[model samples]
Target: MTINPLEYSAASHPGLMRDNNEDCFLSQPEHGLWLVADGMGGHEAGEVASAIVRDTIERETHENPAISLLDTIQHAHATILKSAAQGIGAPGMGSTVVALKSNSESYQVAWVGDSRAYLWTPSREGGRLERLSTDHSYVQMLVETGVIRAEDAEFHPEKNIITQCLGMQELPQVRVDFVEHQWHKDQWILLCSDGLTDEVNDKTIAQILFESNNCLAAVDQLLHAALTGGGRDNITLQIIESPLRDNPLRKGLWQWVPYLTGKTLVDAWIFGAALASLVSILFYVMYF
Candidate 1:
């Protein structure tokens, strides 16, 4: 017998008062994975880093859905380094990643840096949202040791100072969690960058999702609330829907981009193939 697919929903918010928004998201049912990346750097470098993370995740695992999560994330890290090597000052750019992989009743999460995933359940106080991913931030360390209250951690001036991120270091240590045993019927998973948590409170977020008709509307309402509350960064979100035999494109469209555009395709192949050859060395020395 075939098992039923699990429900999914997610949202991100950009907080009040910041210039360059640097967040990215992806949701694909074939792979049964979702991700969010929060990037940091000077100029538009933050965006570049975030896009690299998103692109790597989309490209690597989407092709072979049976691979292990650690292997996919490692591939993504390598790709990020390769992308950074193409730029002069990209060494300083980096991003934080949070990912979820689900199969029917159970889900596994992997994270590095400070982006978070939370699971919400019913409570006597009208339901509580439990933070599933721990922040790799300076403030988090302080809070963990009883040096500060959870409430104080929220208002701490150095709360945004995260200790880990993708592309910042050569090999980031990732924390993987198997949230296997605690599955619930109506629980919702929230994946977000710090921007949303920095602005609106958790209770409000829960209310919005609980009252909304569907996942899409829930995301829309979150964006609206964030903007109203004060949007300081770039915001991105994806709502995962149950897997269906909607299209064979689940595995096809992902790799077809190169073949679709002849000129672009030719250019990519030429670049990809020419690199690690005599031509790339000469080009790099002369121009780059």
Candidate 2:
């Protein structure tokens, strides 16, 4: 019998002040993995970094029945550099990355930059959401060593300056984590960019998920929460599964491979925006 390995669902939102959104998400139910990346460097450069990460790492799932968490992340790093040299987009752009992969019983994670992964579970003494990745940012370092309080991290001048990211350097920073849980319903998992975590702390995030939280609501509420709390940067969020993973079909081959492709009318709007963004980015990157 083909055992259903993992079952999951997820969502993402682009929050305020980005002319072009550079966030990306990938969920492979069959592989029991979900990824969220928040791109920096702006315009087409940011978009390229994020897209390459999502597409490249996800493609590996098609070949292997089970993906090694370490190998997947390292391959993603190489894929991004290869994409840059292939003449698809600008150079020197980079992005923060967080990825989660689960088996039938346990899970593993990898991270870099300020993006994060959180796990919530119930216990005999109740339950809690715990952050599993370390932020590779200047402010995070300060917070770690007791320089700035967590409350003050938002306004730090270096809050947005990530010390390391996927494409910014030849060697990227990565951390691997293994998380254990009962994989039950109402056990929430969160992956968000600095924009979301910058505006909302762990307590606030847990409260929202505890309240009226589903895929669409979580994305909207997180974006609004960030905006209300100052929204200084681009916010991207992906809340996946209640506890595990599930697969969904992808469609794109039938339509114009070179011309036009998408399901809904709103997708056409996104395409138009992408084209406009591509043109503006060409001038901005080339001239300036």
Candidates in order have lDDT scores of: 0.69, 0.69
Worst 10-residue lDDT window for candidate 2 reads: 247-256
Q: Write the per-residue lDDT of candidate 2 for residues 1-288, one digit (tens) a residue.
A: 122444344545555655567888787776777888887667888878888888777887778757676676667767777777787677777777898877655566778777888876532233577888877889888999999998898778887767677775557544443445555544556787777887898888776665533556766676789889887667776766554322222122212223333344455666768879999999999999
- Runs in model 2 deviating more than 4 A are 1-9, 122-127, 149-151, 170-185, 213-216, 242-288
CA-RMSD of model 2: 19.0
| lDDT value for model 1 | 0.69
Per-residue error (Å), model 1, residue 53: 1.2
lDDT of 1 by residue, 226-284 (tens): 78777766566554433322233433443333443446456567656755587778988
What's the TM for model 1? Answer: 0.73
